[model samples]
Each structure stands twice: as C-alpha cells, then as structure tokens.
Target chain A: MAGGGDELKLLGTFASPFVMRAKLALSFKGLSFEDVEEDLANKSQLLLESNPAEKKVPVLIHNGKPVCDSRVIVQYIDEAFSGNGAPLLPADPYERAVARFWAAYVDDKVLCHVLEAARGKTEEEKAEGLKQTLVAVETMEAAFKTCSKGKPFFGGDRVGYLDVTLGGLVVWVHAGAALYGMRLFDDAKSPFLAAWVERFGALDAAKAVLPAVERVVEFAKMRQAQAAAPATAGGN
Target chain B: MAGGGDELKLLGTFASPFVMRAKLALSFKGLSFEDVEEDLANKSQLLLESNPAEKKVPVLIHNGKPVCDSRVIVQYIDEAFSGNGAPLLPADPYERAVARFWAAYVDDKVLCHVLEAARGKTEEEKAEGLKQTLVAVETMEAAFKTCSKGKPFFGGDRVGYLDVTLGGLVVWVHAGAALYGMRLFDDAKSPFLAAWVERFGALDAAKAVLPAVERVVEFAKMRQAQAAAPATAGGN
Candidate 1:
C-alpha cells in the first residue's frame, strides 16, 4: 500500500471542487480509479453510508479503506503511493508542512469565504460577500507568488497537490459567479490570479475532471431561482 | 521515522485548542517531547520561519520536520508510530474514515459555530451566537450518543484521536464559557456530554497537558475585555 498499483475508487459529484481535488490527485499520481459520481441533491447510498456523519464527497476508497476529507485523501494518496506519478508533496518535511499549511489555508480561508460570498441573498449581502471574496483572492495571489515563485505551476514546472487543491476551485467559482451574474475575477484587479486560472484551465487532468461549465452554471441558476421563487408557485 | 522511539518536538501556545490536540496525542502515545511554547501574539522567529504561511501553533516537529494543522499532525503521528501508543485510529478503513469524519465534523461544524459564539461582540450578536452554539452542541450530543455507544471514549474503550481532539476543545469551551459568563454546557441539557466531559477531564494525559481551569478562565475574561475595549485601545 506504501508503493503503487492498488485498487482505487473515488466517490464524488461532478460540480464539487472537493470531489475534483481527489480526481485530480488520482490523475496526477497517474493512478487509475473507479470514479463514482454522486448526485449531491440525492446522494447515493454508498456515499451516505461511506460518509454518514458528513454525508459529503469526495470520499476516496483505497484498497478497501475509505478516506474522507479532500485534503486527507490527497495526503493518503501521496503516502500510499510514494513511488509512482509525481510526488504529491515534497519529500522534505518542512516543505511538506508548508504545503499542508497552504492546503488547509485554502480550505479554511479561501473556500469558506467564497462560499459565504456566494450565499449572500441581498444586494448589501452580496456586496459584503464580494469584498470578502476579493480579500481571499488577494491573499491567495500573494501566497501563489511565494509558492509558485514565478514557476508555471504550484509544484514548480509541474502541477502538484497544492495546485490541484487550489486550482480545482477556479472552475466552480467562475461557473457559479457567471450563473449568479457576479463579477468575481476581474483581470484588471487580480492579474496574477486571472493568469493562474487560465493556466489551470489549460491542464488536461483539470479538463477531464471538470464538469461542463455551462451545465454547472445552469444548475446553479436553476437552484437559485427555485430558492428565490414564491412558495405558492409550487416551485420546481 | 516509521516506528516508535523517534524524537518528537511540539511547537504550540498555551491557549489554542488545535495545539492542544497535538499535545494530547503526544501525551497519549506516552511519547516524551520538548514542548516549545510559542508566543502567538508575537510569534518567535522559529515559529514564524517554521510555518511562514499560516504562522499558527501546534506544529509537531517530529524528527526535525514540522507538521501543521492539528488533524494532519495527529494522523502523521499515528502513522509514523503505528504500534507504540494506543492506536489513534481504528484498524478497519471504514471505521478509520468514520473517526476522521467526526474529527472533521467537530472542527468544521462545532468549532466553527462555537468560535463565532465566543467572539460575539453585542448582546444581540451573543444571543444569536448562543442559539447557533446550542444547535451545534445538540447535534454533537446526538452524534456522540451514536459515536460513544458502549465505549469509554470515542474509540470505544480507549481514548482515540477523535476523543483527544474533542476532549481538548471541551476543556476550552467549558473554561472559556465559565470565565465569560456564558452558559455553554448546562447539565440538564447535555447530560451525556457533561458526563463525558468529566470522564475526559479525568484522563491522566488530559490532566497533564491541560492548563489550570483558572488560567484558561482568566485568559477568556481578558480576551472578552480586550474585545469590548474601545477602538482607540488598538484591539482588533
């Protein structure tokens, strides 16, 4: 299990950045896995039973053991298969610590902030959410400048775990913002991040795991409309 | 590094529940460590340089390498020394997933809501915060009833990783609430949790690692005072 070549399965939803994190890791590791796409609205029994407490994706089943939490799944993949594919993390402990720090930071700071922003219902709420999202994006831009250090990807020349973890969110953010008619990423405001998003979009694995942007956008719009619709209408 | 008898160093502060989680793990493993207390307000150069990105504490520098994020640190400690201490996680992968899931659920749901409650600035804010806190606590109580079934600790007899994580926070929540005049844990409302709190409080490792209840209470009072102080006082 510490090496390569084992049965792997990924339980995830198409539009979830969390699920995509695991998918990108498995791909980046050059490890083949059985991808089980879950309906987030009506989650599969396997998904629910596998992760009953959280009842969320992506849950990575490796060699018959399920690892919940996207970051944890990435670490497990890196440790269990150290010899194959790109090393998800650096071999040096300090470097690994830095990577984990950023990974957790993205989850805690960036994702959480962005979700709050996206959840705003009114104009003022949306404005406040946008401000927070900008702050989060700016922080990530600074981190990437230090992390990438002018390299093409987060892992220097090649994409690695940190890149995947942070990069996977780009598609969802952009798609959701478009659906909500929100201007989240402006090239003039966040030049570095805008460019990073473009680079991430160009990745083969990213394209493979990413849902059709239009579909996600439509789904989000539909949900938002339904939520905003009057109760008497028997909203779809 | 993969076995027991490794030199373990913990960089932490006095107040952080996250830091306490790591400290409890080391103590539970019966592993002796050089505890490097960091000034989080004015973090030492080593702490700053060690985890530059986050600059937070409870970094377990095992065999001279730092591991940030309490959950990651616990898992690393558990894996690095598999057989020595009480097994931090279950042997079965699905059960392991369940353990990690709850550990995360507590962090994301309980801790997030509780921290917000603790940080409320106004009376109205405090009331809202308390409402949310009670909801999270009730949900946790129900979850714990299922999790703690036939088990002394969350690990079903022995104190496991999730237990240590939850135990560390329970100490802080109770102590902090008492000092702040916040009634977080009512005996009637959360009897099982209240009893579990006493049981966890009595653990030798918990007793050793936990600061005096008075110290934490004092810290909480000071925190509340500072938070309520005028903007000219330069407190954020």
Candidate 2:
C-alpha cells in the first residue's frame, strides 16, 4: 500500500515491539506490505543489505528503497500516505517537536531502564534498577498529564506517535515486574501512566501486532532464570 | 524568527557541542534569539523547568514552549522556519528517514566511542577504545558515500542535518585524540571523513558554534590534566 500497490516489504522479527511499530503504522494507514520474519541471531541477506549499519530488523522497503528504524518507518508511512491515514505527528511544529522529544526520551530512558532492570541479577541491583525505572516512569507520568490533557490518547482519541512509542512499555511494565516480583506502575503513584497503558493496549493496531501477554510473561520468566544462573563456569 | 519575533530564547552553555547545534540552526535560519548561558554546575530554574526530565542544556524556548535535545531542536528550527533558510533536510520522505536514522546513529555510535576513547585510563584501554572508535568511524565512512554522492555536504552543498550532527564529531576527533595522544580520523584511513571535516569546518555556522582548534587543544590539555590528578584527596 505504501508503494501504491507496488512492492512494499517489511523485514522484522515476530516478538520485537519495535517491529510492531511499523506494522501498527501500516495497518492504521490501511496499507498492505509484505512482512518478512528475521532470525536476528543469523540475519538474512535482505536485513544486511537493507540496514547495513545496524543490520537490525524492522526495515521498511518501498519499491527498492529501504527505510530503517520503527519511528522513522512510521514517519515515512505518515508522510508517504499523507491524506490517506489519520496523521501520526501533529501538524504544528512545536507540538511535533514535543512528540519527537518524548519519542527519543522513551528510547533513551524508558526502554534502557526496563532492559537494565530486567538484567539485574540480585535483589540490591534489582532495587536500584527499579528505582531508576520509577524515575523514568514518573517523568512520563508528568509528561502524559502535560500533553494528553485528559484525552483518551496522546493524539486525543486517536492512537498516535507517543502511544505507539510507549506501547513497547506496556509489555515491559507487566513482564519486568513479574520477573522481579515488584510493581513498577502502581495506580496510586502513577495514575496517568496506569490509565494511559490501558488506553494504548486497547488499540486495534496494537492488539494486532503485539504478542499475547502470556508470551511476554514467559519471556520475562526466562530472563529471571538466566539472571539466576551462575556467572563463572569452567569446562576445562 | 521561529515565532515571528515572539521572544525566542536558547538556554545553553558555551562548551557544549549539543548546545552549539541549537545556535547553528538558529543562525542558519537568520533568526534572532536571546542566548542564556547556563552554569551547569548549579542549573538555573529556567533550565530545570525547560528540561526537567534530562536537566540538560540546549533547551530551545520559542515564546514559552521549550524543545529539548539538540537534533530535535534543529528539526524544530527547520520545520518552524522552512521558508526562511536553506532547507536542512531533503524534501523526499525516504531521504528524510535516512537522514534521521544517520543522525541517530551518529548520536548512538560516534559520540559514545569518542567519549570512551577520551576516558581511557591505560595504554591497553586506550588502544581498545581507539579501535572501537575507528570501527564506528568506519561505519560512517561507508554511510557518507551512500548518502552524499560526491556532494560537498550531506544536503548537497548546503549545511544540513547530517552535516551538523557529524560536525560535532570534528571537535571530538581533534579534542578526544589529543586528550589521549591518539588519532581517530586519519586521512589515509578515512579519506572522505578527513575531507568532510574540512568542508564542514569551512561553514560560517560551524565556525560560529564550534570552538577554535587552539581552544579545543587547550580543553584537551585540561582534560588530560584532570585525568592525571589523583581521584581521592583529603578535604580539610
């Protein structure tokens, strides 16, 4: 659909929330694209050729040209299919700048903290990780209140950039806490974030691309197990 | 200039290349703005309120609304003052995506490696750091050929997003190496990169924002001295 019925392909993995960003954007635009699953452990030729620098998945190819990164792909979809789909970014420059800032912040802080928290191997380390996680979540809680203004979503009744950017956080908040037996987004402390997650999770686009909650739980459980495994092993 | 003379302000410090990005964009657009130098050691109220999440400088204040992050601020300037200056990004959507991706890659890769190499405390660590630095530099060396196509700059003879983003690397390649007496960009090793630095350094905006080579050398010497100083000292 992005190529106007010409070849439009997406190379990504099944469980990557980043990949889901492109899918959600394409689906929201009602555009058809071929989806190719990637084995990240052994990247395919397409992945290598499409995004040589990172060689990571979620590369959107329109005709013969490749676009890398989920946010960039989403922006491309919004721009190429402008007037067809509801817009992802705000038309106003200032508002768009704010959205861009938040998207980058989620990448720079939220996702990293979630992964760091998940990587913790001991109670003390996990606690420190959780503290940082809450700090990031609290920042978002304030940001949501400032930007959303009591709307159902950041785009005001429509799923948009911030919602999709934070969509990955949905699984992480649930899965990360379960792995550590700790709560991250408590309703009392972060009421706005709690409500926003529910609103974002209910989106049709998100539902279509995200793996089941059980799958994420299993992923987190495996992570907890991996952390429990001893670090130093000797075969010789 | 961004808001039609509606009180544009930039909160930043002198030494920060990230802050210089905002200055470069504003000057490129020929915009008039109030420049507030922040004492980063004791961040001011305006800096704190403008960028609460990061508490970092380079917050562009158009009227009362604040935009954080140097690259995002540059994008904001381009969008807000599209008709005023030479366009900073390509008109094509796909090209825009590629520019954004590379801008991000420069942030994620080049800057970090440069910092790591500068932070090296031992000979072996410095060599390892320099190797990784060159590896990232090599990735960009390849990226330049793919994107520039024999153009003087990434934006085809104009100072553009990729140019400004990587121009920060110029100061680093000089200062970072001098701090540790190592070379990250050699003409024989990275011919395009060395030439690219020359072209970028010639830009008026680059000259305005970037510290002079002598100043950077002094800064590097100061960094070396700081690193040489003992970490723990008794305070009366």
Candidate 3:
C-alpha cells in the first residue's frame, strides 16, 4: 500500500492494454489505488479535464495531481513511490536508458503494428501491418536476448519498466492468438519471447491486473460484430 | 565539461530537429562531446549497429554504449552527468512527469503536424495538416503558459527538458516563415510561444547548437527543387 497521505486514483477502462500497463505497475509496486472505470464512449468530466488535450485514459492521479499517458504515469509511480517497492527503472543511468529505449520500442514498433494488423481497413493493409509486426517481433527477440542474457526477465532477474510496459499486452496476446490464429511469439521464430510470454503472464501481480483472456476475446468479438452491423444494414 | 573519465560521442545529421534535441541537451548540461556528423543518406555502421531496430540518428555513445532515440538520449545525458550541470528534469517527480508530458506533446502533436503541413501529399492534405498544426500550436501555447508559470522558461528560470525538446525546432520555425509564410507561433494567437521562440534561440547554449535559419531555408529550397525535378522530368 501507498503511504497514508498519498491518494492514487486511476482513470481507465478495463479493456485497454495501455490502461493495463498502469494497473500492472501499481500491482507490482503493491500500491493500492481507486480503479475508476471510464466509459470512453461518454467520457467523464474528470477524464476530459484531467487530460484536456488528448482525453486519453490511464491517467493516474496522485494526491489530486493528474499524470496523463501510461508511460509517464508508470514512471511517475516508480519515482513518486520510490521507497515502497522495487524500482521499476534501474539505479544505473545507462541501464535505465536501455530500459527506456526498449519500453519505447514496445510502444512505437510492437504495439502500434499489432493494432494496425488487427484494425486496418483493408486486407492488404492488414497483411502489411502483420508483415511489419513480424519484423518488429524479430527485432524485439534480439533485444530480449541482449537485455535478459539468459535471465528470466528483461530486468535481469526482476520485473522492470520494459517488463511492465510489455506485460500489459499479455491478455491481448492470447486474444490475438484466439481471434486471428496469429501468435506473435512462437517456438519456431522468437523462442526466447515465446517462453517469456508464459513466464511473464504467470506472475502473481500480472495475474491480478491482467483481464481474463476469454473476456477480452468476447469484447473483441462484440466490437467486430458492432462494426459489421452498420455495413450489413447499409447493404440491405 | 563532462567528468575527466567520461567520453561522449553523438551521431547525428545537422538538418534534423531530433538531432538538434540531443545537441541542445548536451549544450545546456555544459557537457563537452565529440559531435560526429552522420551522412543520413549513407548511414555509418556504428549508427546501424547502435540502433538496429530504427537505424535513426541522434544516437549518443557514452564510453562506447549507444543510447538511441532523442528522448531517451536527453534523459540519459541528464542522468549520466547529474553532477556536471543544472538538472534538465525537475527534482520533484510530479514536475518531471509534467515536463515529460509536454515533451511528448511537442513531438507527437506539434512537430508531426508541422511536418504533415509542410510535406503532405496533396493540397487538401496540406490544408488539413495546417488546420491540425494550428490546433496543436494553440494547445502548446496553453501548455507554455501553465508550465512556465509566468517565468521565462518552461523549467521556470532555467532551461529544462521541455525547453530542449521544443528548442530543436526554433530554427525551423524561422525557416518555415521564410518558405511557406507559416509561423506556427504568432503574436496574435500564441504570444507566449512566439516570444519563447525568440528567447530560447538567443541563449548562449542554444545559439551554439542551433543551425542558422538562412542555411535551413536554402537547404529546404534545394530539397524542394530536387523533388520537383523528378516530377518535371516524368511529365516531359
């Protein structure tokens, strides 16, 4: 739990992997916070006011001060609550830089490509997105080899910033496999990451925060069905 | 200067704002580094190996360990040389988070839209980009007001991370006016930012790193002429 005077409140939806990053960070740190579920369709006044520019979720309010963006929020949690938990960022400056580099890679290359693969407008676009995603995954596998150096995690025997950043997508990875028959990390290609997925997902903290895979699959299905409904009606 | 034992090298192109960010950070921190100019058209092996994933410039090598990405490099410089100069990130965690939020906004919102407006595919695309750029500029103007707190700089009386992040674009802001008659910040709309451009550019450290405006304008014109040549030849 956080120090008595500190009040942490997370404004996010259940389904967002970005939101999950914040939850996982908090859980790993053992910091308790009010998990405020948001209706993105009808964004709350707090959400709008908290992040007036972007109005995106996963805004972590610490002692009434809003820290927007998951990456910023995660780092904030680590820095603000430094004494309560194992540090998310490393002590050494160079190591911290490396961790930050990979954390950025996870978002810029991996997550963005994955989203494009799943949500592209055309089959060709989706195929291109998948192709780029495979390249990103291969690059990430190499990064894992370098960073982990045979350790169980990227942080060399501990869960750190990169772990938490990528850990957010654990459920979605399963959901992607279920819906598309596409496993991002597989035994054939990215063997290290393939094993890492299982290892990371099995963590108690991760289990607590990560949404159920079946529930995510159902949500995705519902979203797809809704998207198709308009097209179907238009055709009629 | 950096500590006696510390050796710093930066790989970057002169024209790139991303590269300028790294330069600005180093300068503001009063760190002396060997500035190695990279021919982006034919990248160096060091850059390729240093950043295998992105192969982008602005890779800072400290004692031979390469840190890629401008954002990561800036933060790394601050951390690695904590004792050398004034801290780029604020000491308080909340303030650091706010600085980061604005730094990200500068990149994702302000710079990106500016690029789109300048180099969009069609007239309509350019127009839309300009419209978005105006919106982003307005938001950033407000950010400047809130962050600076009636002070001269975003760091409040000293140059900080957000200043360096946005400072990279100071030359371009001048060049844009010369080329496209588009001033992203103007007295009428974004008075703070308009004044900020002039104040940030005049600093000794900033002046040392920032490229000349006329040089940038000449380079832009040359590039534009080259682009037109291919189209002209194809038409003929």
Ranking by lDDT: 3, 2, 1
Residue B98 lDDT (model 2) = 87
Candidate 3, TM-score vs. the true structure? 0.97
Candidate number that wins on DockQ, 2 or 3: 3
Output the lDDT of residue A52, model 1.
64
List each candidate's DockQ score. 0.27, 0.86, 0.92
lDDT of 3 by residue, A129-167 (tens): 899999999999999998888999998898989999989
Say which prediction, candidate 2 or candidate 3, comes out ahead on TM-score. 3
**What TM-score does each prediction get for chain A alone?**
0.88, 0.86, 0.95
Candidate 2 — number of clashing residue pairs?
Answer: 0
Query: What's candidate 3's DockQ score?
Result: 0.92
Off by over 4 Å in 2: A1-4, A121-125, A177-180, A222-236, B1-4, B120-128, B227-236
> What is candidate 3's CAPRI-style docking category based on DockQ?
high
lDDT of 3 at A75: 94
- Give the winner by DockQ: 3
- Across A51-105, the per-residue lDDT of candidate 1 in tens digits comes to 6657888898877766789887876777667677678787654565567677888
- The reply for model 3, stretches above 4 Å from the true place, is A231-236, B231-236
What are the candidates' C-alpha RMSDs? 5.0, 3.1, 2.5
